[model samples]
Target chain A: MRALFLSLAATTILAGIAQAEPAIMPLDRATILAGSPFDFKIELDQVHAAADVAVTVNGQPYASVFGKPAEFVAEEKGKDGKVLGSALIARGLSIAKPGDYTVAVTAGTETKSVTWTVYGTPAVPTAKNVIFLLGDGLSVAHRTAARIMSKGMHDGKADGRLAMDDLDHMAFIGTSSTHSIATDSANTMSAYMTGHKSRVNALGVYADRTPSSLDDPKVETIAEALRRTTKKSVGIVSTAEIEDATPAAVVSHTRKRADKAEIVGMIYDVKPEVVLGGGSAYFLKSGIPGSKRKDDKDYISLFRDAGYTVATTATELKAADGSNSGKILGLFHTGNMDTKLDRSFLKTGTVDKFPDQPGLVDMTQTALDQLSKNPDGFFLMVEGASIDKMSHPMDWDRAVIETIEFDQAVGVAKDFARTHPDTLIVVAGDHTHGVSLIGTIDDDKPGTEMRDKVGVYDDAGYPNYTDADHDGYPDKIDVSRRLAIFSSNFPDYYETFRPKMDGPFEPAVKTETGDYVANEAYKDVPGAVLRVGNLPKSADTAVHAVDDVVLQATGPGSDEFKGYMEQSDVYRVLADAFALGAAQK
Target chain B: MPFALRRRQFLAALPALASLPRMARAEAPELTFDQLYGGYSALGLTFSDKVKLLDGQSVRIRGFMAPPLKAEAQFFVLTRVPMALCPFCSTDADWPDNIVVVYLEHRQTFVQPNRTIEVTGRLEHGSWVDPDTGFVSQLRLRDASFGLV
Candidate 1:
């Protein structure tokens, strides 16, 4: 029987050989849902006539299956005045059944073959009203610190609980990009939102070799899919500019995340029902005092023209709520919103100029009120962007407060979910950072030097922050005892064992030689110590960590998240929830 | 060097004070970030009278150093507040329009964000692309120098 089976397989391999070039879309070994639309392409290393290159799909001519002719482009440009190769491209194709698709393509001497696994979703829907929250780069250290600071630690146990402590489902998400083990916000969130691994800084498309960012072969995004299949409203809210990596991933498709002005246009193109966050600067016209655009593409007016209620202040945001405007475009700050530290306490950053900005909790509430109106439910993404922003500077206090603010937003989501059981809440971090809070810095138990105040292990004691008003945040950050947080990686910096009462911390400064050195402003702060850096001199702040990020969720599909999973898998669950692949007339 | 919000608020709120001509009152309506532009949009921005009238003349601006482009360059960007996370430092970094480029009279070392410095230079307006770096600046201070307050 074995000999007979071997003979049959050998015959099959022999019959598979053809004068054709192998074509792959939902490219080789891709796990596609029964009917997810993806572009199919095949490349020939050398310039070959279209008739000379033969293609077959599942042992038949590609024409017999796809029923369309593929456009052929020969002698694609190479750098330095030469042609790279020839290729074939076909957009908007999909296989409707669950099975292995073996694609074979052959040119004279060169040959290529690939396979893709097309899968189907369960017949029943799993979750509704998905609320996906991304804490840009939340890590274990940040979680531990938030628990200790907000809930307090007793002996070895946390005295209370974080908003995520009781989440019924959890997962350790691997955020590595398609090209490298390390990742950034764009590709990581792109994976979560599109179920396709992309190169760093690239979103909703493969990182093709071509120089043009928009010319890359594209994949359908969840935002596009949701729009195509459901009447459900989509909302994106973040402390970072809505055009920033994480939020933009929800609806953008560019190889570069820095194309914010274009991303704003893309967001306008999609017109997510409710949009709130900073980066009003990107929305403003080119000649406007605060606009960051190079052209006269006034997005605020465009959104308004499209019937979005525009608001620039917390008071205005609430007013827009009463507007029954149906769509809201809230531009809180001209840039990234100030972290909670600067927003509530220091009154630094852009908070002074853009005062009356709403907190994450407020933004979430406004979004829920507006989105819940539709009977079909909604999809919203909230980001505590400053968690990653402040953590990069090793400003743990600010990051923690931002996390607490994020938790408050989560609390609001959870409360909404309780009242509306149909809602699914997913709280996660896009990546992690290399920061930790080991113990405490006690000025009361210190010598003249700064390091002497560091109390690790047994010597570490409770922090002496005062929250007289009972708000989650401590009353004053400059307490005698405080969290001894530090970043594992850094550029040259001064370690000042105290809160930057004036503003957020500035750890490093550049020297005349153009290398980062410890910023000297804090050098005279009593016991400030200069600590040499470990990262490259070009690094102005600490960087994101490659470690797995912890994710927690609740609702029907939330159970699919367990142990460890790739960021891309998150999208599959989402597709199943919205029945994105279910045939639509 | 205390941060006086009241002073900044006073200067930013009342533009009527700006009517105090240089020849009349000892002080002028102190133009601020709030006064530089009145609206936000995608097409373009409108320059406040303070910035428009002060154009081509010497004026003072405060901001922190954007981590410099290089050590030998004669210019660097001066942004509102510290460039806590400088986007221009990286090739992928985005610049805010509110930025005021300072072309120094002489080369000087870049300072960290924590230090707030006062700069004095000729305020020039309109979009002008830099020949050296191709950096487009709508507002610039030619022949400028700064002092740590």
Candidate 2:
């Protein structure tokens, strides 16, 4: 019996040893853009002397192929003060040629190999400017609902079209991260901004197994690439904080997106010509009342000293537009700006405090106006961020209204594209949500319970949302007959089956024991029922779906965005559009 | 002679007892969350005149308590609304702009987040960093005590 136990333990130990192979960055099947710089790294399972480690590219010594020797670390320590492994890191490595290159590593008893495809673009540029508009967590259901609510559907399909509906070129983008099928805004946008697929919550860098959030394998962001190769202007506009994940992906390099204070420094490092959004909190000194920074750095004064025209309100933004400085930094709120529903109609949120926050359209138009002054052209990215922010809380009314506002920004881009035919317009979502527009909820046909009022199949008749002013948005969200939008997953919460009129919905709240329980504030609402959660208690609200995001584009070089492609592949198209490989400088 | 002496001692204690009611009537000045700030802008927020006047004085404010950083903590954040997201649990979540950090005089048991509480402490304004936790707060209540309202 003792011998049998000994053999069992031996089997387990052998399995552990077999699994401890060396890990490689720029993981297998990675696509690299020629001349774009990236950090190369290798993490070995065990410590080894410098002479014991062997690395080669395409059967040649790695140092000869990369044109430099990598820094060797004897041991890498983890957060718990344990020695993880030995590592080799080569920073700012680039391959100027385009071909299939295989990297093989061997140390002691472990061996690992990865192949990368390096591709190059044509010598001449296809587009002089690129306008990338992203709607966070945009899905087919959002587009359908936005069209139905804003354009008015009849009999089946008798409505106007969204600005995105007219884009001639289209693609289905797979948004999975390198580490998991699920994704977040940071890595997904980073995949578009940098031609590399990184782990979730990471931006412009691969998520290396390290304790430090900043010491990951860095990839060159699009902003840095433009700075490296061209004299074009760059602009980033969003409804979220300027340091939020989506906009921060434009120039940031970190393994964690929550490093807002550090991300502000990165934004300062890149210094995109036009940056308009919220999140002035990080830019302020720690002594300020609304500041979120933990240090004494005041970025507002720094930007002003750098010749930027700082604007804090819409009136100031308008006045700054008339300035000849050609550099504008507009901060509309301390945190994320108020959604359109609150800012324009409801006036329920923090809008009472931040009354003059600019909308997405206003920021996009201002960005274009400023960026166009550069005769060399520009690259502008506009994001409608609240679509995902409100969707997580299951606030369907605010999410759809944000979509309409996003579409108006798309219209602004399309108008710019009409005159500047050399501009390429790409509209996409970083990821998707499981929410869908099933049918309608009719108060007139309602019974006692709210679920009984739900109309599905043929019983789902048209809603009675009216746009009296001919504006895109419906006049009232609390109509008797309204659209029924529901998420596929949620935490334990009360389903009211009505538009949240007071403010954004708070589905669940954390208890003292760290479990999420249904908020009792909505329990007294008539016909509200407690629905058991399908998601884990750890989830506060709905989560991002793993489904593919639909991408639409038009203008020159947009034809390259057809068919199904990986999220990282989208950057290659952008790179190809600008001829970044040819080095215009 | 003993009864006469006891009567005189009781008369002396009556003056000390009479000031108790007057002390109770002079409660700390009540401050609301809405009155904490004078103006809000992207640049920063300005302290209201009332806040400036009440600085370094005992004041009471009613607000919801955010979940503490730990089970037993020396301090907790007081927010105008019950926080839906746990900034400690999720890296992406952030605290609201109107939060006030409360440093307790003694460790007290936390209550439900949805329950409102009135905290009485010396209202202090200006940025101060906690030595132990390194938490930076623009406004704080020092040596505070709270009870559910």
Quote each prediction's TM-score: 0.86, 0.95
RMSD of each: 9.3, 6.6
After the best TM-score superposition of candidate 2, give how far the Cα of residue A159 lies from its true spot, in angstroms: 1.4
lDDT of 2 by residue, A1-585 (tens): 999999999999999877687889988999998998999999998888988999999999999999999999989999997988899999999999999999999999879999999999988999999999999999999999999999999979858999999999999999999989999999999999998999999999988888999999998999999999999999999999999999999999999999999999999999999999999999998999999899999999999999999999999999999999999999999999999999999998899899999899999999999999999889999999999999999999999999999999999999998999999999999999999999999988848888989999999899999999998999999998899999999998899999888888989987777878787778888889999899998888899999999999999899998889999999999999999998887
Cα error, residue A40 of model 2, in Å, equals 1.0
CAPRI classification of candidate 1: incorrect
| Deviation from native of the Cα of residue A433 in model 1, angstroms | 0.7
- Per-candidate Cα lDDT values, in order, are 0.79, 0.92
Q: Cα deviation in Å at residue A266, candidate 1?
A: 1.1
Best by the TM-score measure: 2
- B49-88: candidate 2 lDDT, tens digit per residue: 9999999998889998888888766899998888889988
Scoring only the A-chain of each prediction against the true A-chain gives TM-scores of: 0.92, 0.97
